[model samples]
Target: MAKTFKYAWLSKLSASSSALLFHYFPLRNLGYAAREFAKQGLKPGELAIISKEAVAPYERPALSKAYLFPESPARLPGFHVCVGSGGERLLPEWYNEKGIELILSTEIVKADLAAKSLTSAGGETFSYQILLIATGSTVIRLSDFGVEGADAKNIFYLREVDDADKLYEAIKAKKNGKAVVVGGGYIGLELSAVLRLNNLDVTMVYPEPWCMPRLFTSGIAAFYEGYYAKKGVNIIKGTVAVGFTANSDGEVKEVKLKDGRVLEADIVVVGVGGRPQTALFKGQVEEEKGGIKTDASFKTSVPNVYAVGDVATFPLKLYNELRRVEHVDHSRKSAEQAAKAIKAAEEGKTVEEYDYLPYFYSRSFELSWQFYGDNVGDTVLFGDSSPESSKPKFGSYWIKDGKVVGAFLESGTPEENQAIAKVARVQPPVQDVDQLASEGLSFASKI
Candidate 1:
């Protein structure tokens, strides 16, 4: 006889892709945009978000800053601990209050491009006159190096709430008090800075010789690297995590590095990168490992279906090509595009291409850095190289054929940033650094 088992699941809703619908994680900024759409009294339709993390999409920046607040000591809490229920994300009840319909806790299993419909895991089907898919990303996990106990409690990944909490608790309780961060990418550096500020002995290992090789220039990276080193964070460059050793109780005791040096640690936090969730996507949408390719209008190769967020590697007018971005702004912008397309299509209008500037922000040791667009071309920089705080705290540059690409400066100064960003975009002819600096926005005035 089969043993009795019991479980409960949330109720489900289905929608026609043609209906006015929106999709996104409940608590994320995407919720703000969706609430805007609901202002139109959109017809309730099938909307879904396949978030791999259990928590509603709360702000991720808090994961590292939570302990600093006076409210609580550093402790490892599960992903959902901070995020309010579906309420935090504006769940169906919220939609009902706003006269909008949203379907949550349901995963979309397949998209019927020909029929303009999507299927849920429970076999529920929604034919979309319009649809939006906003499931975001899963963190790229570390591979065990086959060393015994490499998978033990001392090792942790920081993708979800549980991951950050576990690492935080472990770091606080360490006897010898050592921590090793295996990557110097955006997430890794952020966590490493937090750990160092907390008075923990932290060693951050970076494969690339410089910090943020993908985002910042060598000059800026060198400055930040030195700054971090001065703050007691052992900066390890061009190295890798090779192995781990267990204590007498079988818990991981040390992290062995490729340089034959072992970092005695209470815990190891790995923050490599993140990728879109397409592992189970078997639909007929033209796709790549990066994500499903959407046209300028956010439509996929499949007719009647559109993809958004980290999953849709959509086209960019600025890049003049297709690109996949992982920024939080990209998610909001992409969702808005798909929403506009749906709203217009329901009214029988032609679709327009979605063009958006990529933006992301990070905090490192009291310094605030933000990027407006991808400035992958030649870079010209202006700033005092000295790490001392008394100097001017602004750096501006021209990227991509002298297009205003980026700027880093003290926070709470939006007007100055806007002016510099305007100059960066003008592609102003530069006779010399002094000339460009003294007379700003000669080119911008033309626009």
Candidate 2:
């Protein structure tokens, strides 16, 4: 719950005002910067660390991939990964000597804004000159979805370490080896791919017409559905799992669909969606659609207290309410800005406003993809997929008010996305990109 700060674990030192880091890595890109602050001359006691997870800050994405394929864990970029055998271990060797307090197994229940103090699940209270609230989100379970035998042996949500562990065990133990993953969202499809990799008979069910229906256009969504089906995963669309019935052994054996057909299965993975972990901060924070509302600096209606990661939902200058991100990258970006604002205010300097482009990256099978800016809404297409044939790449830009608002470049590093981001981060340019494309000029050059 409430522990002390230690800093010898830091690979290097910054020494600014000791900071209290919340959540685990990669979001701690904030703490990485805090070390830079330390070298600039802040004291060792100026830093503190806290996390609710019992292990090192590992990537949640892996739970859906690598845990099923042992070799996948070895392929991660060092700086981009997290988690110790237990959880996010900032590592005693890294910061123990710096006097930055390390508190694990503790939960920061609420931020007492005016009092400059925080309350924790341990019932212990601590005061902070400055604080960071990096509490994240939780998976939306299918228990309330009229799913019978919801607690049956194989019904699970793929979110936390335990969830991943359960899924791995279920896949490994299924002697008949028939696995069903409910919902066709990003997490669902990715996890389905993981199960298929192990040669398991995997089937994914979604109520929509295509996979990733909420994110991509119908054409793109169809491409994905076909792509996964080709890889040996049976995708059942336009149907919902209205009711389920299991065997006497409390095992999930049959899934009944609204179409009045029953499909047999050995296990099921649920990834319908997720909601913010706002119960702890419920009445104390301003919220809409169940997420914290914050301004540029992540400042809540209450002062000196800030919220980041999945729990906070703020306006994006470029997308308006159009952007409500819950990705790992968005969390880190927002936390870094929030941390800097805290640091500047400490030195009696004017805080720099927080403004950033929203982005998300995921590997679907062998394809590596990254998206920036508004990938949805009033979309426009550019380039030709016919050049590559079987694995064609698509390029398109999102327009608003006659300006290039956001762009999506499937495949590659989304170099065009990076270019348009500079302009999209503030406001859409007045230039007419559609006209430019009509003249045979590439979107990259126009940006």
Candidate 3:
């Protein structure tokens, strides 16, 4: 099956003097980049190769969402690149049809930026005139922090398709069991909700006072915390998982906390966070904030080498600072912009610099929230947050310099969400804090 899929994506090749290479994971960014380059009239023999460590390019985000559902699990070709962006799915056959090479399960261990070459773990060297690095990020594991019993059988840290499979199987095998979710980020939150829905008694443990401390304000966290509690999920905040105890079969039995509380657990899921996969080019490239440093065009210091997705820390033109965005939206746009820039450079033409607006969203249970722009300045939370509200609706506007710079909403209508996005884009001024808070979605609608 794997061999057939690989060859099905193999197209006619030619002896080209130069080639374009993409070293990435199963991310849509590289797919978009390849599509963009082809759209730019890349010659047939130019040689476009996409090498990935995964056996097939599938959706990574679904590993925490649809893949967890016991009834209908997401499978291959369904969640491939572009589909998530409302475009045609790029299956293995799609690559072959385009004459682009699809090199799966090939890990590029070494990259020589100056020489414009890469060395695979299998001792094969690939030379490229242009290289796009979209290796993405790696999930931080309990072993990274010296947490004991992390190697237990039922302990999982999901970052790939295989990891998701193991987690899903565990959920099936241990029905009505206890689950301990470590971390308070999107992964933890989403996984907890799904596990609880699967009949597992889930206990979420995090060191922050509320969930998603990185972005969710205390007011925003309160609603989610209350909602989860209502769903019978045990919340353990302001605490960290220190260790784990495994039974004789090497399955986690209990999770030890910093507060001397040991919670019984049949399964453990960790989502502490992840660091960019930049070690491959550690000294060979410039890095900022633990990610490869790039300009507005996603070009690295080394000529002809462009970095996109989670690996590149490019300048955020909107905020006038350097940032490495992890969201899928930024990854897609950055990859398209970088590919266009590369084509323009080849044609002796110049393109516009990337001017991106930060956007992030997460959906769990019946609730979904989206945030756009920076989360700085005074927060004006509006709408109903009470747990008893039949149709709960609430949002927050970040007021910076008397203007709305960021907005987050829960249960917002489509039009209301668009209004919030517009407010963030325009950074409209707020007349009065009290009025803005009272008006809520109305203020954004007017703007």
Candidate 4:
């Protein structure tokens, strides 16, 4: 179901509040900000987080990874916030113990930045001196593309715990049935593998030529494509699902392709992409690159207003450009940085601005891959990509201005991944492309 935002005002809280945060999702960013605010000696009941989800902040990345495991999917409290960062999990009790009010299942129906006020769907209003907006992103649906039969009962989109729960139940109910995974991105690929593991005949469909076209080169995509093929996952590229045929029960029964092909499908899952949720503050704040524009400190145009997570398009100090990162690492780090900046401002102290390097990773079956830094410049593929190899270990390096600016590795050890990050940060000069490709991991290790 889609959520519609409406603006209305009926009641208002006393204008005695000090700080407030509004996040549409139960994001780890809120938990991180709460902990940082406590560390800064902010008193209990001084800050609050208004969330649209009833659950506490939890690890979202696991929703695609361990949360889909057929045997024992990850449950609540296990993947709670801060736990994913190797810190103590912040449960509901933890928030209460810290005196931070977590107003869950509330939607901000109206936002008045000039007056520093927010009115919830219940007509309750809250005022604040400082505000943090971490609205996150919304998944793009097939309805957005005008695809037919999107209202089918068996079709799904993975975004929240509720969505995941529905998919999990469907997986159990549709065992040994056919599945069609729409899109070739991380969610599509990972979900296809998990569905296959659940004993479903999965067929991945994407309009792109290969998986992860935004980052993965053709050579790198080939490895994973072949691997999925070996696992009995049919990949249909260069075509898209134009419509769907549903049974009398309103369940999707077949997928219609553009190339005059129709495939049977017991279930359908779509993961095209996401759009940053910043419409609530469209004219209230500066906007850029499809997100709320923020400074290096994550401060927005409005005084005492800061934006973080997927909705913040802040300066990428490493790349000398403004970019909005949708990954979890940036979400957590930006929240912590913004909290620190707010604390410092109150105390008349200065904190360092955020300087983040891009990092992304995904895991499926027995394969895991990690990428670091900007993927610009000439590409150099290295290591072994052959499926026949006992251990398929391979990587790629991006050379720019005769220096290594980015890297990617599949099945890399902890230290090896760390080395690649360092190489990206330092950007060591490469004397020769052939020699650099030949050296591969050795070059990063030396860096």
Top candidate on lDDT is 4
Compose the digit string of candidate 4's lDDT tens values, residues 276-384.
8777777999999999899988889998888888889999998899998989899889888988898898889989979898999999879999999888889999999
lDDT of each: 0.58, 0.61, 0.78, 0.83
TM-score of 4: 0.95
Global local distance difference test of model 2: 0.61
The reply for model 1, stretches above 4 Å from the true place, is 1-33, 44-55, 67-93, 99-130, 144-149, 248-250, 350-352, 390-392, 402-404, 410-412, 433-447
In the order shown, the candidates' Cα RMSDs to the true structure are 6.2, 5.5, 4.3, 4.3
Which structure among the candidates has the greatest TM-score?
Answer: 4
Models sorted by lDDT, best on top: 4, 3, 2, 1
* Tens digits of per-residue lDDT for model 1, 258-357: 8888888777887777766654445666886578788876777765566677778877886577888887667656766766665576678866677676
Q: In candidate 4, residue 317 scores what lDDT?
A: 91
In candidate 2, what residue range of length 10 has the lowest lDDT sum? 8-17
Sort every candidate by TM-score, greatest first.
Answer: 4, 3, 2, 1
Per-model TM-score on C-alpha atoms = 0.79, 0.82, 0.94, 0.95
Residue 339 of candidate 2: its Cα lDDT? 64
Each model's backbone clash number: 17, 43, 0, 0
User: Per-residue error at 18 for model 1, in Å?
Assistant: 13
Candidate 2 per-residue C-alpha lDDT over 237-337 given as tens digits, one digit per residue, 9 for 90 to 100? 88878766788988889887888878888888888887766665567767865677888777667666666667677767644562457887776567657
